[model samples]
Target: MTPTATGIAPTTNSTPTTHAGPAIEITGRLGERYDEILTPDAVAFLTELHHRFSGRRHDRLADRMRRRFEIGNGRDPRFRDDTAAVRANPDWKVAGAGPGLEDRRVEITGPTDPKMTINALNSGARVWLADQEDATSPTWKNVVEGQLSLFDAIRGQLSFTSPEGKEYRVTAERTPTIVMRPRGWHLVEKHIRFIDRTGRGMAASGSLVDFGLYFFHNAQQLIANGSGPYFYIAKLESSEEAKLWDDIFTFSEEYLGIAHGTIRATVLIETLPAAFEMEEILYELRDHCAGLNAGRWDYIFSIIKNYRGRGARFVLPDRSDVTMTVPFMRAYTELLVKTCHKRGAFAIGGMSAFIPNRRDPEVTQRAFEKVAADKKREAGDGFDGTWVAHPDLIPVAQAEFDAVLGENPNQVSRQRDDVEVTPAQLLDVHIGLPITAAGVHGNVSVAIRYIEAWLRGLGAVALDNLMEDAATAEISRSQVWQWIHQDRETEDGTPITVAYIEELIAQVLGEVDRRDGDRFDDAAEVFREVALREEFPTFLTIVAYSRFLVDTE
Candidate 1:
């Protein structure tokens, strides 16, 4: 069922009431157990958060736009001279790893559906990233049900049964630590409206709704279970944003009567601007900070999106060619480890989005080999842990970290003092091989297939043996847009234009299966709107959500 929102409904005896605050109204249908999550106290908590921090969220988003404009006008992002003290000071350190997060060698990331929640927790990894951002379609049902799943999982009641009578349950005696990832600050939840002091109504902040609901419902319970409300902050562009999160964490602890510094967050240094402010970001969130992750896919997309107009030197080649070993990615990851260990925080590596194909042994073996090599590089480079998308890869990633970190929780003590990265090294995108026709076709195919699945309410889809999520989709479409705008030609010197791209899209669509209920046609339209348009869309997900996903009933 596609969840939609209408106007507010009058409160009944069964509904939760907000006695003294800015009013909130639920426009989406209250499914079973939804009321438990959206109780009176929970609504009031969300209302309070909106009243206090929504304006600051708007200001931060505006800052992002202004910075993007400046970058398009040739203003390069550099490390801040004013924040040098935060970088130079060797005495300060983050609050380090929290209780269950001390050893996160193999973390598995996936959506929060009941089945996935069961699989991920029982995957034998140290941490399960119950992702609500990139790996979830934010349909109102998904939004509420994801929280429900996490709520049940935390209480040891989450399980699922397939139509074929197979049962899925978390049988592991010790499940992974749950580290929830809320949506970024850019998105909004249209199903709920927050009416402020002036009677002005606005869509609730997605970040606040996700974090607030989870924290409100599960913070105390998690604390009792020996795990705090840990998080992985996504898509932050500056340290000021980190400071805002820190403030939110502090306020949430106070509001819930939890201890100060009870919440720990690991900021994903994904954006180009964020790469320059690693130390400052860690400093801002030091009191509540766990570490930083090399969000490699989104980091690549950020580079292409921010510098798309700057010509060939900044235009990256095919997505496949931009491996972590490239000079630019190496600079980002090495610098992440250095900055993290320097501040006494855990340094988590990026996701190895490889899914084993059981039908073909050769293919699965190759993927395993590649994943092992990738994890080995990360482990050798001083990353305390890394992420994988499949359960089968847990031992593969853990073995590498185990070889490096035997009898130790992490290698935070092995600080890479010799590592130094420059602004040029971070911005260097000229080292990869040239683009090819095969690359263009691959991007079009993946974007279309992934978008179709996402439109169908599935966020993570395995395509051609790789687990493709929103981050991968963003990089795919953005690369296509960048190539067309820069008038990039394939290695064979065939020009890339809108006409050629349209033809390629048609060909790719033909190759896709026309299933009975598939959304391939709609997905193709979205691709054209985002990739073929003259003006670049900030996010393809936002565009598709506003048009097709948001249904008002």
Candidate 2:
């Protein structure tokens, strides 16, 4: 029998509540609404999650560094032979589709701000990726308030009033199911501290804090609403990481007494190594797995980070030129679909980050055509669904899938057995336009603009009709670093040395200052430090968040 919402509320465990529970300390400012979400049971659930799995997360992280160091020392990664047995088994399949995930034909992704939360729930997409990782700046206010808003959202009690007297509410006849994306394994939520065994106050795992609190508060509410605890796991690099998450789901479900397999996850194949281990990753999370998503921007960033000094062969051109149609990207996406369908899982497409600009007809038309073409290709290639950044592009993607699906829910049965891919094809970056002056300048401009917005606690920004996020900033800086590492020259025959790129940065910064009159020195310093570094930082947001983004830490 299904549990009632009240049945899922905080249980009176004899384990003791306050000082004996988690020893968690909230250093950030808490609003009146925070109490609703940060109850004793929620904090205990997060504490339990941290105590149980953070060690494994740490081990996987160390494994990441070891593997990356080997790569840096000229050891190229290949598909793991140990996991061949898991992949070679043709009789195995992932668990049957969970509730509210039967047909994810279209998913919209955004932060969980008050206004954006209302907008996302109202967006006509089939799923709303309530993102806290990339689409959000992890300010303390943003973090706690985002959780508060999500709590209200799950119970259908969400509403918002803008400072300008504008009111927004969820009014959709069939609102999109919410699939939350927490921070990656590398991040730590410093605002939430707990006492360790040695009596040191340590920051809690960001993943545990986000996922645990949400599941504790809303798991029963969602099951009552006919959905389960759905998640989009971001930036995982290996199957062992997937196994850790699967273990986490099992533990959380059992601890809360929710049914097993009620938690479903869609792994984001964002990193280069993860693309090579898709089948193994799915196999690890088969019981709790939903599908795999193509996270294109991060994939590009990963290639650049993994093979930074590998030469001109790995040097990519402009971010714009490296589209889905590019050879390496095509290989990755095709392999993803084939692998997921072969395992009887949904193969979701990447995000079309174009947001319509209503003021200009020409710009809007161009974006429409580009989005239409992208979605059409995905639909034709047998992707069950695709993602869009804006509600305006929903119909554009929906039309393509509708034409292909007709009355069908998904194309999971269409196993692409004929498709075969090799490691060289997935790593082929040799085919793309040569770097151009425009490309160099665009990277500098976009990085500065996005970082400045991020510093001001906004993650998603519309610049020239494209919705840029943290991934955009990462790709921009990483691409520049890659070009510098190779000493590559632009189409104009100018070598992309640090000095030349610094000149372009100065030019762009001057232009931005003239238009906005707000100094961009902080943003410029960040861009320079990341792009001009001898070795790339895994994620720029890590440094930025610690040094510049904290509000009350």
Candidate 3:
């Protein structure tokens, strides 16, 4: 069969080789074992599997492994029903620039603090990550299910008005743009059947791989019924995992008579392993992806528990401070923007747990201030948007997002015709450059990237251009990126350049001079002023050098 124009090759054998069209095919020796790709043992195992099980049966095993172990391939239940409807809705127009679907509206699941989603919508929030995952409490989780049933029951007469003396009621359809949070890695089955769609059976139970397969099967079941998400897929670790789901989606779409590319998917970069594979996973599922969100809490835990060696401890923290300040995390978020933007995807940041006006009024205010600061900071850092749980905080959150939404980054990607250099990439690789006395001349690379993000409105920021943004309150990100960049390599192994780099620093710092003039003074800063002055700068220096000679090369 002729596959899609890009040659839809199934990453797993369970996927149909006979696609809508054949774009890619593997013609090598057929193997049923993982080791076959390299060692003789692998090959021998595949040989045994080939003889032991039918081709279709063996493909199922590989398919399952790819889903569970791979991390980011799991699906979120909230989106299960609306992808196609939104796509088919007469109002569902495609976005001109963002990745996946263009109508980047927020989905206000009945339980997702409706006030928050509504306000964010008013304030230009792109999409809300409403869920069972990180945002909602357990009580809300149970209530959300009931809400779903209410909305689903009156599918037709959805609008109702509660009169002052009387009351208003109508069909309670879920909000269109909110992304649902799954129960977690442990409860994907429950999420898939009832939460994702209406079902009450063990048919939905399975492991990570099995859940992914169910997504395909379920999507196929609902495609004609006008149900099922395109999804905010989660818990994945490898590009192979992404490819596997892509295969399943492809196979299922064909069976269900849905157009192959209509099903959109997003990955939750919730852990360190998932973080590293961000680019690759996006690349692999470029056709089917909606976008990627940085899962802050999970990612923080993952960094500590799983990716401790990868410059994590410093950016995150040992204490409850849990700041996403590590050079690597900063780079990760910036790259989240860069990777998604490069491919025209939406770069969404993780959630802010700063629920406001709590029992601790002071804590709530600080939390509010922190959220407001974070919004502007992350926006400047390259993100298109971010998330929050409380309605009061949404206004500040929306304000921050809006500040930089259309602000073209004065990023230093410009080059002469036939030019092949970029500031960020240059700073990532080419570390042999001579050093200045402040430190190795090579250390300047760090300052360069940090300055770039700042100059480009991504670094050193404040709200209303005041002490509002965290970047301005701390160190500039482009500086860290520049240092990391010059020390790092381009994806193609080409060395990055330093010319645009220094310009980035000078230009951004120049902006700092123009707006706040380094009066980035803060009695109550995101990080304590004393700590920022004493340890952060020096720590950044060490991180910069680590990039210069680290095994990243």
The lDDT per prediction is: 0.90, 0.85, 0.40
Estimate, for each residue in 482-529, the C-alpha lDDT of model 2 and write its tens digit: 888888999989999999988998898777744353437888888878
Look at candidate 1 and give me any clashing residue pairs: none
Q: How many clashes does the backbone of model 2 have? A: 0
Q: Tens digits of per-residue lDDT for model 1 on 172-230?
A: 98999999999999889887887766656778899999999999999999999998999
Each model's RMSD to truth, in Å? 3.7, 4.7, 19.5
- Which residue pairs collide in model 2, if any? none
Candidate 1 residue spans exceeding 4 A from truth: 1-21
Which candidate order results from sorting by lDDT in descending order?
Answer: 1, 2, 3
Please, what is the TM-score per model? Answer: 0.96, 0.94, 0.46
Using lDDT as the measure, which candidate wins? 1
Name the lDDT of candidate 2: 0.85
User: What residue runs in model 3 are displaced by over 4 Å at the alpha carbon?
Assistant: 1-125, 134-176, 181-228, 307-318, 358-364, 406-553
